[model samples]
Target: MKVALKIGYEGTHFSGSQIQPDKRTVEGELLKALLEIGVITDTETADLSSSGRTDAGVHSVSQVVTFLTDNPRMALPRILNSKLPRDVWAWAYAEVSDDFDPRRHAVRRKYRYVLNADEHDISKMRDAAKLFIGEHNFSNFAKKDKNNPRSTVRKVEKLDIRSQGPVIKIDIVANAYLWNMIRKIVSALTLVGNGTRDIEWIGKMLDPDNYEEGIEPAPAYGLIFLEVQYDPEPEWMIDNYAIKHTNDFYTRESNRFLVISTILEQFVMQPEKGQDLD
Candidate 1:
């Protein structure tokens, strides 16, 4: 039987999401748990795959992974959570078709970049985000790995920037993303916010020949895999309650922070050399 899993992880401790021979990873921990439950004997024969790989220190709220198992005694979510580390949790599972491939069938993937733009210009960051909305060759925005043969051109469905006090959230939805693509974009926006780069700098970087080397990618800790979407099929049953609850929580907390932020901004903008009446 093939099982689809909705998993969440605090990626701060792992090397990355992919399974490594020696280093710790989300995939490694998951496979270890599966082995403990007698789902598969070894990595050689295990048919496990993830929606996509997240870089080291990156986090995930709802990552999808799938694996094949023959053990009828294994109750997936219960057994996996028992054996997995405290930082990783398997929330839900379901039987998927034999032909299902998380990487291939995914319709869209959304990522959120969290930034503490305490003293930076939020408007500049939002303006910079506009450059990434359409389909374009993002070769300069991603690290080119030889293993990936797919083109860098991708359709970005949405890119929005919003601020709540010191935290600036960049929500991006796209069909797919290349390695380090989101991070590089975040780095560029930071430069713009700091007045070091202008809107034209973004245009220049997108030019094939003007792409410069050694542009640093943003830190991985601020990035999160917000969600993934698959094509709507009759057999797919989504847990709407879980989705609504999570989004509602984020929305409430975001607004609370924004209120506090606005109050602080007012104080900062007040004249410091005014004559005191007290």
Candidate 2:
């Protein structure tokens, strides 16, 4: 049987999503858990694929991963959750077609970058974000993966910037993303918001001739894997409404943090101004 899993993880503790030889990673931990439960003997026989690879310190709310197993006795979510780390959990599972490939079958991938802008100008950042919507060669915005043979041109369906108090959330939906693309875009927007870079700088980076010299990648902690979209629904799954509710809960939590952050920023800024009066 082939199972499709909806997985979530706090990437702060791991090296990254992909399996590393000696380093701790989400994939490594997951495989260990599976192996402990007798899911498969080793990588040579086990088949596993992830929707996408996230960089170190990035988090995921809904990540899709697929694995193959011949064991009929295994109850996926129950067994996997028991053996996995506290930070990583399997939320949902389903029997997918053997032909289904998590990476190739994915229609779209969504990513969100949450930034603590503090006193930065959000309006300016939004203006800069407009430049990212549409198809473009994002060589400047992503760390070139020397192993990847595919073209860097990606179609971005949406790029939205919204401010919830001191935190600026940048939501982007695209067919695919190159390595470090979201982080680099966030870095550019932050620089613009801080008045260090203008909109013209963004334009220059999009131009293939000038791109390499113009952009810098941001830190990895701010990015999150928001979701993955597929065409036809797969078989052997839980109710779709349950998944929707789970995502809604995440949105509520984000909003709650925004409120607290706004209050803290105001309190901190006021005391500094009061000191000058004294």
Q: Candidate 2 — worst ten consecutive residues by lDDT sum?
A: 269-278
RMSD of 1: 6.3
Compose the digit string of candidate 1's lDDT tens values, residues 77-113: 6566778886677766778888899889999999999
The CA lDDT of each predicted structure is 0.82, 0.82
Residue pairs with backbone atoms closer than 3 Å in model 2 (clashes)? none
Clashes of each: 0, 0
Q: Which stretches of candidate 2 lie over 4 Å from their true place?
A: 72-75, 239-278
lDDT at 248 for candidate 2?
A: 68
Q: So what's the TM-score on candidate 2?
A: 0.84
